[model samples]
Target: MSQATELEAPQAPRTRKQRQAAAIAEAASGHVGWMLLKIGLLAIVDAIALYAAFVLYTASEWVVLGVVVVVAILVNWIYFSRRHVPAKYLTPGVIFLILFQVFTLLYTGYIGFTNYGTGHNGSKDQAVASLMRSAQERVADSPTYGVTVVEKLGALGLLVTDPEDGDVWVGTDEQPLQKVQGAGMDGDRAVSVDGWTSLSFADVISRSDEVEKLSIPFSDDPNDGTIRTPDGRSGYRYVSTLEYDTAAGTMTDTKTGTVYRDTGVGAFTAENGEQLLPGWQITVGFDNFLRAVTDASIRGPLISVTIWTFVFALISVASTFFLGLLLALVFNNTRMRFRNGYRILLILPYAFPAFLSALVWAGMMNESFGFLNQVFFGGASIPWLTDPTLAKVSVLIVNLWLGFPYMFLVCMGALQGIPSDVNEAAEMDGANPWQIFRSIKLPLLLVTVAPLLISSFAFNFNNFNLIYMLTNGGPRFDDVSIPVGHTDILISMVYKVAFTGQTRDYGLASAFTILIFIVVAAISIISFRKTKALEELN
Candidate 1:
């Protein structure tokens, strides 16, 4: 064929199958369904983020609002853009890590520097308002106005009407009284307003606590007094016995003329060193840390707990590892009879939940009418959990039982990983089994297991459940103000300080938590560095 005719010739008639395949490939490349699904999911996520941002803004949490906005923007940018494929994959995990781990650590650090415990948990303005509200008393011969309880958007307000002037007003705790344009009245009393729903007698009874605590101001002026409802039907004017001076920052008692000035330690204090409760949270810097070291109430118990913590962790690790290694070595033999049976039996303690096992042990070891005392010890009472010394020993024994099986599994794996030739060479030499284990086998085993040992130590250090369920950290210290005990570790002590009492000192607990993190990090770093020597054995 001529060159011009060959170039101009039609190739062929396309097959139906080929045309169908081409259409499928084009649809796959477009990814329209996938893109739509992705956009739908993104839209839902953006909606949630926007709602959370709005709530945070209303709460005046500016920093958190900023973070939410930034995260939402980043999420949209990464997923929608073609260039940020890696970021799209990483965004969820990074966001979760920041929200759960990084944010928690940062907030704990912030609490450690602030007076964020009970009675010190709000802003200065809130504290002032609370103080004023708490100091109110009904003025003698106070005028009682007919009132109706109404609710709007979950906020309760009072619809008050004057029987004398026929003037009506509505107010909530946050908003002062304002005249309403339209009202639904029952004679002289206002039963409802335009935007509010009147609550029934049953609803008022159900919300008795709220009704009793309701205090709506008469006007914007603090001196004008507040309208308080006693039984939802009648409102009385109540004025504060203590008047606050904004410029001088003092609260003066109108009756006694006692002045309370701002102490800057989160409370207003009198000249006699008495301070009011429910003060605002303030930055106390290192006061919480200093309280850990110097305060007489906590210092002695803290020192005792610190020493016991180190001792408990070290002893627990050593005992568990020793027993576990001994068992692993015995079962590592191929010629051993019923090896699988024995291995399963050894792992029985680990099969059941650790907390359940602890509870069982607690029951078994009880001093009165317990299994040990009644059945085994001929009715002689042994204070396994009651005596201070016995409690510590009991805790160790229980932990060893609970902890050894894990170490057994780990040691067994490590033992199998070690080459048999090394032990053979040691035996062929004059070295006996003990010498081989100590010199050759032990060092090699540690090359793999040292990191695990360090981790076990850290885990045991903060083993809260075992201590809490086993002893409840009892054999209580009689002299201390805090509810710490002889057997309490630092972590248990922190729990007691932070939550178990009438007064929960969260700031102090955060200080202790930071100290623990520091200690564990230090020990882990040092232990990891020491493990480098074991690596040289290879």
Candidate 2:
């Protein structure tokens, strides 16, 4: 009987729905911990990526990194979660990524197209914010003077000094100076009551707010004049008090009634046309680009530079490829002795410090004292750095030396990957060495190295370091309106505009930089597409 009872009581019946509901509840309970762990990992990755991107100073790079982090987290969650995740699981991340992409792309593209720059540069909102902040800081930090009372009557006069500095400030009772002092401090402490006719301590305390309104007088008179309060009552006036009108953009002294007005230029002025301030900033849109494009001062020799830039890039790519392929072919044979040693020697150019090597090459290329000119061209000066055409050629030659090792290394690996059967078949079919390479090796190598060649071209297009270190785009273009050089590339031209042009035309430089990006991106995209097509063929 006991055995039968135990067996019958072994289990309580449970419905399939109840078991399923219990499992769902358990899965739901684990979600908090699981979600937190996933989010933590994502945040760590994002922080690391953001820090690295910020260090590199890539504009809009943060936006890309953020999207990658969110996508990574959502994908992980979907794969790991036990409970059925709804489409809403990824909704937040997807919306954020889409918004980030759209905003950053539009912003970068717009900035690329606009003249936004420093000193009246940037978007309209940014400009206004910057201006307002500057104004606020200026107002906050302005110097204040202490008042020294000389006399008081129906009219009042006062002497003030910026005790922090030795500048004397004076004002009259009828009209005070525009400057004010002691914003929140004791008003009486800022003033010394020495000579008085009717004013009492109560009057001084009542006008505590007016302590900031006091100014130093700028009147040329030996005896100080008087100041009247706004209520037609008289009070001591500080000399430096000023009247400023935002509408008129003018500041006037109450005592001398001298007025200074903004010229709608960066400077302030008197009513007379005589310049009151020397430094003034003026906004001129697209003018810098126009000058760069059209002015004979820049244009005449710029024409020569434009041609040389193309020539330089072409020669660099051609020479590097030709020399690199030759080396790769020579070294591709496995039977060749000390192959690793030769590879190392060939790669040494890439391993060396670029700037240090560039300087050495510059010295060696010196026409009179240089190794090449002295050894071959004799002691005759060829002006390698000074002559425009010679400078361009010299730059290309230097770049070829610097750039070939990379291509050689890439080609070496690529050449080895080509199946022996292909080359053998080509040779068997009556192909010469040239034909074997042209048909079999070149085609296969291009499938791998074509993208690299395009990348190299893009890099050389903005090779500021090589250009800067070599000739500094020198032999100045004489006919240009502003100072420009013969060998200046678009990047160098932008640099000159931002730093060396008549005005630090940052807006114009920014606009030009955007144009340069468009050109580079277009070239890169075309090359990338070609590489992709080649890969498909392979």
Candidate 3:
């Protein structure tokens, strides 16, 4: 009776106005800080969105601006609206998945079908400007103009005084030399312009490299010669040896009278197999893929790399699993002493980063100064990382050291999880240890481990870090034009093709990546299907 009265005392009766006033006061007292925080965060987001909108508009990136505006509006609506309960959690994940995964994959696929390499990276206008600039040569009878080296916003420009009329001009790499007023002349040359700062003699000497390299277009027309200063004091008129016919879509060599036509293959080629570089990107569908098999220069090396990749992945998975399983079995005895200490010591290599471990092993495998040769082999010159066969052996050994600990962990857990009754029953039936393991425990272990082995194989197949850090795909193949070696796997080959050379073949690398993806996916699917057979052991 007392407890009931205590509970009922808090519900004391009151007037209608008093109840309404209490409800409003409770709400305000509890939520004021949280409301203020939400408001402040929203204000910050609005400010950032507005700033981004202004930048995108100024850059004339309309497609990107529209996307930003729509995303900002959606984000605001999702957070502010009371009806959007689940969208707040799912929106961020969906956006990141689309941007990082879907967009990257699609862009890479698009690149695989195009000639987007060294000389074919940018747009048509940039390529045109570059072609004209590269072929420019000094005209024999060109006029000499007085010029002053000037700077604006960290960019170098030329302040030119026309030799004939004495008109002052200023221009940078992106800007054509044009007439400007408000010139402050030192003697006969316009040293200082209105919007540019004239460099002192000391400054010109300090930035001699930049001053020598600076070439400003004389005007908008490509036919007109550029203004190039030789000693930062005198400018000369240089015209391009190649004349471009914009309307006719042709480039003619002024010296040889060879007409180069746009072959629609990203380059301008002449009739005799000559090509002018600085070409723009163009799509050449399936040519990159076909070159992998059909082209003589790439096919042999690619085939060898593909074979080595398979062999390396297969050997790495098998060796690591067997070694780890052996160690786990030896240490799984209940009566073993100091087994925990041994286990910790074994896992030490795994605790460090894989790339760091590979680097350490690379140093330790050096023939002349390595710990293995000096301390163990009595300074014998063993080419563990140089010879073709020894390099493969070294890679496998190092991979075994780095990979066995993870397998040991998984195999240990899987072995311990098996029921003791099954082994006891097998022993009671007069079965030997080997028979029991082969028939009973091993089958059960496979039920859990087969999927993991497939994943490990896939990982080792694309193990770029080990190859890159250790050998850098060295001991180059002498017979092939492609920059591949005996130690180079498919992924490493792709990396070298795309980045290491003077001509980075991004399209071919992307094609190789797609092929790798298809191979791995197919193998994984088939192996997963085979693993379904192992479930019967469960």
Highest TM-score model number: 1
Local lDDT at 493 for model 2: 73
Ranking by lDDT: 1, 3, 2
TM agreement with the true structure for every prediction? 0.91, 0.59, 0.84
What are the runs in model 1 whose C-alpha is more than 4 Å off?
1-37, 162-168, 184-186, 193-195, 219-223
- Computed on alpha carbons, the lDDT of every model, listed in order, comes to 0.90, 0.63, 0.89
Q: How would you encode candidate 1's per-residue C-alpha lDDT over 1-538 as one tens digit per residue?
A: 6999999999998899999999788867997889899999999999999999988986789998998898899899889786878888888999889889999999999898988888898887777778888889998988789999999878999999886788899999988999986798788888988889999999999999999989998776665779999899999989998788888888888889999899788988999988877788999999999988998878988998899999999999999999999999999989999999999999999999989999999999999877989998999899999999999999999999998999999999999998888888888887998998888788888998899999999999999999999999988988887899878888999899889888888899999999999999999999999899888888
- lDDT tens digits by residue: candidate 2, 64-115: 7676566656655664565546744665576577779866665645544444
Q: How close is candidate 1 to the true structure, as a TM-score?
A: 0.91
Candidate 3 wrong stretches, greater than 4 Å: 1-61, 139-171, 175-208, 229-236
Pairs of residues clashing in candidate 3 = none
When 2 and 3 are scored with lDDT, the better candidate is 3
Give candidate 3's error at residue 383 in angstroms: 2.1
The residue-level lDDT of candidate 2 at 238 comes to 27
